[model samples]
Target chain A: MSEIIRLTTPLKDEDIVKLKVGDNVLISGVIYTARDAAHKRMIEALEKGEPLPFDVKGQIIYYVGPSPARPGRSIGAAGPTTSYRMNPYAPKLIALGLKGMIGKGKMSDEVKEYCQKYKAIYFGAVGGAGALLAERIKSAEVIAYEDLGPEAVRKLVVEDFPAIVVYDTHGGDLEEMGKLQYRE
Target chain B: MRVVDVSEITEAVAKLCIDANYNLPEDVYEALKRALDEEKSPVGKSVLKMIIENADLAREGVAPICQDCGLGVVFIEIGQDVHLVGGSLKEAIFEGVRRGYREGYLRKSTCHPFTRANVGDNTPPVIHYDIVPGDKIRIVVAPKGGGSENMSMVTMLKPADGLQGVIETVVKRVDEAGGNPCPPIIVGVGVGGTFERSAFLAKKALLRHVGKPNPDMELAKIEKIMLERINKLGIGPMGWGGTVTALAVHFEMEPVHIASLPVAININCHAARHKEIVI
Candidate 1:
């Protein structure tokens, strides 16, 4: 069994550090969705000193580009995307007070190092378990990059959104540890 | 000789597109159940359990199995004696995809190459067709997700590298892919064809039933060995780690130039969505 913890958006630095690799988290409150395209625009905005679409302080940005919501649905089957594509832009956002990332796949060594240095934690959601994960989201609204279609940045209110800590703030890696445990 | 209307093809393809997105093929579903029953790592078992549950929910058409509904990859085998009437075969397929994505509430994942602009209707699907001897046309719709497709690889090994070389290449691809392609992946290996055919073969191999083996027992043995070696890597379910890194390994081989041994690796996420129709 794994440790179950509840986390809210605009996550606290202290709370992030308390999460060790492999902890199970049920994230609540407001979270933002930003995939590869949105990350690019945010980095460009940062370089130009232009304002970001939303404040990054204490935020957990999920790497997702959700499918179109059907009639009367809050959102379509929303799930974490492969996070490695956003590696180039993650450390900058981490430096700008981003506390957590919810996405699937491994981060780069640079991103891993930055998570430790900047006190951010990277979590992995089930990659293909989108339909199941969508049940936890209560509301969805596009906030940026409307032209990106499914890749648009959306703000979502989630309740008990589940994830596993892949990279802890202290540079621990759950995947490596998990793999080693079963090695024969 | 047989006559078939392209409109019928369009309707069939549209339905297939939606069905493939919502439903996990029987073979894939059974393999996931087996993986859940067999996986040793507790975390791995938990992930597999979630995957099995997800499949049940996705079958209702409430939402696609994955957020990435995937590009519409269609494989067709048309009998030489059949007369096709109505719209262009290519257009019919795309039209089906367009209708499927829009009406089924599936994601439109296709995009223009350079600018990354959304293609809107998920049109201009990736399609392959071959002419066969029968009077019936067969179509298989495989919604290939980006996560796994991006991890696929192709290499030209020196013919002397032999079968061992091919095995090593596939195992390495899965190892490097790790958690990215989504674990308990179904690996499709295309061996010995030319560069292009090898890639196509790899993708085509994915259309095989997950638990089925090549009729060639020698190649089936290779697939078995490859599956065993891959599971030993401890990638497990969703890369959480366990004894079931891959549910199955399907390989298709063809003759190649004497000097070149080309091999391609295509990985399908646990969501391996595809369905077949014969007309």
Candidate 2:
């Protein structure tokens, strides 16, 4: 196991530049949540040259549509949704200055190519570990698209949020590496 | 003949929904534990450990095991001797799903496919009904998540494709899916019947307990061989890579049309949530 790197949200170029694939990270601070529906809306806004519900520059968008909070809790079982569904909208966001994305599953080649070109990073969270992941989120408030139900965009305050670097700007690929290492 | 009220069905379905979401079935949990023990990679073991812990946390009734609570899939075995009264069986099940999702704090995942409109309540559940001999109704609720559901596929092979064709198609489906379906996945293979019936059987097979072999010795042996081939792909846990890519491969095969050999594969993530009730 490698040293677990600590990171704060709204990641800067320097914060992500030195990172490599397979590095473990504990991200703390504010991040935004958006799934398939919200992504489409955001992209439409950008295409129309209108201001987005949130900024893309130096921000991280987590692909998740959390269950409703259990009254006293700030969030419900919040975990990463499949990232591939967001592949189409990701490169557009990355090109517009989104520096990091947190989600599970494989990303497309275009998204990966954009990440390499723009010095961005893609982190894979443990899929299906929702109840456990919600522990890292201190608070959540919908920032836009309330009608989207669980898929609404929310501003999330997190602490020690766990994830692994799956794709790095420096051309390291953990998915491929992991498969090759153990492949029969 | 015995009479059964739709309200009774509704109540049971509602409760089953909540219970299924909050607790991981013993079969699934134990299979995961066994996978953890057998997994060769440190990362795979750690991932499995997190899954186990998440299941424990969800049992506290405070959080769900996964955010994708799934579009509720219900399987009901209705006794032919029972007369259902007070409401339509279909609407009663929908009412149960609506209440269960709203009250249990489960996510409403159904939508207008083309418009992408939220359906408010998780209704129009994928309900499968079977006619049996008794006076009771047996309902099984299995919430199918999008991640694994998206990886499922159906193919119509020539009759000549035979057993080898079935094996190749299923193995290839998992291989193509890789980690996207969530590794250490439970694969359900359906053979024979019509093209659509085969797909249905593949899904129904997912309702079976993980790690249990098919009752038919011939199919059981094939299940074992297919499982070995899938794990050898080294998809590992969550595709992080390792030795335990799949925990189990289950099959439900039936005799089909002489000209058609249809194969359908449905993959379920390790979190496979399901519960059964008799009323």
lDDT of 2 by residue, B1-279 (tens): 999899999998898888888899999999999999999988888889999999999999769999999989999999999999998999999999999999999999999999899999998899999999989899999999999999999999998988999899898889888878877899999986898899998998898889899999999999999999998988899898899989899999999998899999999999899999998
Off by over 4 Å in 2: none
Model 2: per-residue Cα lDDT at residue B237? 93
Which stretch of 10 consecutive residues in model 1 chain B shows the poorest summed lDDT?
B54-63
Each candidate structure's TM-score, on Cα atoms with residue i matched to residue i, is: 0.98, 0.99
Supply the TM-score for candidate 2: 0.99
Runs in model 1 with CA error above 4 Å?
none
Per-residue CA lDDT of model 1 for B144-200, tens digit only, reads 899999999999999899999999999999988989999989999998658999999
What is each predicted model's overall lDDT from 0 to 1? Answer: 0.90, 0.91
Assign candidate 2 its CAPRI class. Answer: high
DockQ of each candidate relative to the true complex? 0.79, 0.84
The numbered model that scores best in lDDT is 2
